[model samples]
Target: MFQPLAELPPPALGEREWLLECHCARPVTDLLKAQGWDVVADLDCNVHCSSPDRRVYVGLLPESQEAARGELWHIHVTDNSGTRTWRQTFGADTPAQAIAGFLAALIAFPARYCTCA
Candidate 1:
């Protein structure tokens, strides 16, 4: 069953920025946001280990179905706009609980950042 976004624990990383790395992207995004931090953007890739095809992406704004890439990450995991900065790029499907916990910490302590979607 999908973990309801609203039920997502408060940011686990004790910060506001998070990078969702998983096959189940949207749902995870929902869960993180439910914790309090807003999702600025996401990027799904076609493969791992940076390629010319490798590029920073924004999944939060998928223009169409073609936007679904294999690997994804938040454009600015560490938005320095605020007091703190976050940066992370990793593989998805990282055990739900661990991810949830990381996100919770981030939410509890957030820095200044743009209002990304």
Candidate 2:
């Protein structure tokens, strides 16, 4: 059984629950999967999703330099030539619902246009 971080109450001080909150990726991954994206998780449990020209990552390690400082969500779109066209990141304390809101907007956005433009 998978439990989403959004449904959990706030963690108590020093609980260290945040360390294991990678489950926060579930809703985001599910959303991408339902939208015909390919979803996969690495051995470390980081979730990656990809469409034809876009990619999304959830629960990336804080130690990863590619990840924003302490960020859990990383999303990007690429051109047909594989150049990055758009990108966004959200920090560790960001709620799953908030990440979902951003992802929903991205998914709803037309792929033929550049959101960054």
Deviation (Å) of 6 in candidate 2: 25
lDDT of 1 at 59: 37
lDDT of each: 0.42, 0.66
Kindly provide the TM-score of model 1 when superposed on the true structure, using C-alpha atoms: 0.34
Per-residue lDDT value at 93 in model 2? 75
Summed backbone clashes in each candidate are 30, 0
Write candidate 2's Cα lDDT for 16-53 as tens digits.
44432343676676777788878877777677777744
- Error (Å) of candidate 1 at residue 46 is 10
Best-matching candidate per TM-score: 2
Report the lDDT of model 1 for residue 33.
Answer: 51
Q: Estimate each model's TM-score.
A: 0.34, 0.64
Best by lDDT: 2
Q: Please provide, for model 1 over 1-117, each residue's C-alpha lDDT reduced to its tens digit, 9 standing for 90 to 100.
A: 779999987786777675444454455456555644344532532221211122212233233343445223333342223322444533344544454455456555554454673
Q: Give candidate 1's root-mean-square deviation (CA, Å).
A: 13.0
Off by over 4 Å in 2: 1-23, 52-59, 66-68, 114-117
